[model samples]
Target: MDLNYYDTLIAVADDCPVNGAVVPALRGGKKTVAVVQFDMISADPGGLTQEDVLFETWLRRRESDGLSESERAELRAQFFSRSQACLRASPLPKKYGWGLRFDAAGRVTLCPMGSDEYEEIIAGEVPGVNVLKAMRSKRA
Candidate 1:
């Protein structure tokens, strides 16, 4: 399934406690999904699609060091063969105070909560940009 969000901005969760986007830190000497996602997106803004981010994060965390190209392709197919949660459930927006913006081409970039871009997105000042909030942490 294609999981790209075009011309959309996913704002931070309402219950996010941080005032701005914070880099996700290593946990227990290992990179969590949030850290991986943050590192990938922050490294190259608008360079990756949501599917690329999710699959690469999952692949990196696995033991596929010597897999052949076909094997890797198979793995990717298996990974995406089932339903996957989108970025709205991601910790970057729900916990790390970052907004996710998808351009018309479906490439994604991180927008920190207090950044000018984030402000513009949430305020509906950016044309053709649909805004949605990340899933809340608490049940209300």
Candidate 2:
């Protein structure tokens, strides 16, 4: 995977409805927004060579389907901006690999950075630190 691809993925994920928007309250009644930003310039393609082009094409197609060029451009700009905001707002850990982890109670947990479901899980209103275990166990 290319680093640029990863960054683009993250950016796109940030703008997704599942990722949503987060508004953190700061001191003095102020609000702060954090969004995700991708640095595609530094990405290095490791194995999948066509990934970046494919993703770009998808975006272009979606933008061009039924809207004028200006409208499409505006939508794309908004999407990218929102994606950056979401990235800045969230604190996603660096992904190392893909696998499952088990808790002491023998519950299953999946830590996948590439999963589209990640944002939904994180945005869900659930209590308890072991929610992931419950979630995965339920899926099982």
Candidate 3:
């Protein structure tokens, strides 16, 4: 398992493996939880591609917003406290994975990484927003 990729996944998901939830709010506030599962089409074992790294980084950056001081503290604590546990709980599969998004309602949405979609995203296509336009632009 790629420790770096696992770390990146945890950083993006923001969920603790031990508690199965976002680290509790230190000062008491709201926190979002995201679950990213990678889906590889091929059965062959290999490491993540450069595109995966870029996409994951972009996803993490997009999620970092409006966090209060206490919330930030909780995140830090959880990251440190459950780092090992998280690694054990969610090991990245050698093949394809799906990214799950959990909102305040705890609903999980599967985010598919279609090749064209991924390319568009890399080219600055905002998923669910400008996907069509992005796709069209790729042809232009």
Candidate 4:
């Protein structure tokens, strides 16, 4: 995980939809975006970029995609910008009704939108923290 991917100030979005965008292409099938992201974030407290998760997912689907380490690194670098466009746009915040929160250490954790913690955080009642909602798909 990279520190660049960590944000001390978290994004908490409510009223979002569950859009299955980051799901891995698997042999039997794919898991939901929430399942993938949660597992990835949980594995490392440092947090990961959308690309990190996506790359892992892609590898899960095709380990023999055939790219050298250098090539893979280059592709991953390019993937950052590309992934940014998809990450915040993820269904985790866009539709799954989960709030993404970062600790002082910059690790991310999910808060169900229906949870009291989400309400307190969203209301700014939580001390020493900031939250931003996910962007809506269309005009409100």
Candidate 5:
């Protein structure tokens, strides 16, 4: 399938054949767990976009490291637009055992595979909810 900039639900094998592995905290991975944890810990349940999660984490941890305001802003923009690629490439559903649930406002939250919640959304049981699997490890 042709994955658009914001495409949802590109399926991947449960086990990655290329690496023959499932990395819980894959180095340089999308930090899937971190993204989910951030939402779970936040005051609002589904308020942040995928870009918001990445930028907030970056700002909190590395804001003072070296990047200037303009550069930081640019980087955050890259996460959302103009750079290319979509959240289908994110590791949350690719390697980690989770599914992505995009709400009506396009903000997303993690729904682990086979869970009651995940299945509920996948079964078309949630209103204004978009469910998409992560990109697969190998070509279809």
Candidate 6:
């Protein structure tokens, strides 16, 4: 169960409303999945793999109070043991107008839509990088 992409850029969805990447805001007093994902990537661009991002997002939201280090590790193992959706379903690309670039090592970085880097990737100027669009928000 590996959830990593290499030398790839996940472009924004076709129905994305923004012209450029917009930082996701907290929902009420809580962090949304989009916010968590954005923060993690923003804090360490190209440092986290897709599995890291997804698991952290789940962990941050879970009530893990009083859990020991080994307990947390076990929980993490259980989390990834099940099927998980990839970043293509993530709101960063599907709604927030950001792109996800996975490097050769499968570490992810953000590419804001409408940015020069994003344009280069979309235009195939970034050699060896394949482009994939985020999943659509609505059915046809």
lDDT of each: 0.91, 0.30, 0.31, 0.57, 0.53, 0.92
lDDT of 4 by residue, 37-118 (tens): 6567667745654456666555544544778899888766765545344345555666555566666655566666656777
In the range 1-140, model 1's lDDT, one tens digit per residue, is 57889999989999997988899999999999899899999898999998898888889888458889998899889999999988998999999999999999999999889999899778888889999899999996
Query: Would you list the rank order by TM-score, best first?
Result: 1, 6, 4, 5, 3, 2
lDDT by residue (71-104, candidate 3, tens digit) is 7667655554543332212222111222222222
Order of quality (lDDT): 6, 1, 4, 5, 3, 2
Runs of candidate 5 with Cα error greater than 4 angstroms are: 1-23, 26-45, 54-71, 77-81
Best by TM-score: 1
**What is the TM-score of candidate 1?**
0.94
Off by over 4 Å in 1: none
- Estimate candidate 5's alpha-carbon lDDT, on a 0 to 1 scale: 0.53
Separate clash counts for every candidate: 0, 13, 8, 4, 3, 0
Question: Which digits, one per residue and each the tens of the lDDT, describe model 6 over residues 1-140?
Answer: 56799999999999998888899998898899999899999999989999899888898878457878898899889999999999999999999999999999999999999999999999999899999999999985
Tally clashes: model 5: 3
Relative to the true structure, candidate 2 reaches a TM of 0.20
Runs of candidate 2 exceeding 4 Å displacement: 1-3, 6-64, 84-140
**Stretches of candidate 6 above 4 Å error?**
65-67
TM-score of 3: 0.21
How high is the lDDT of residue 79 in model 3?
50
Candidate achieving the largest lDDT: 6
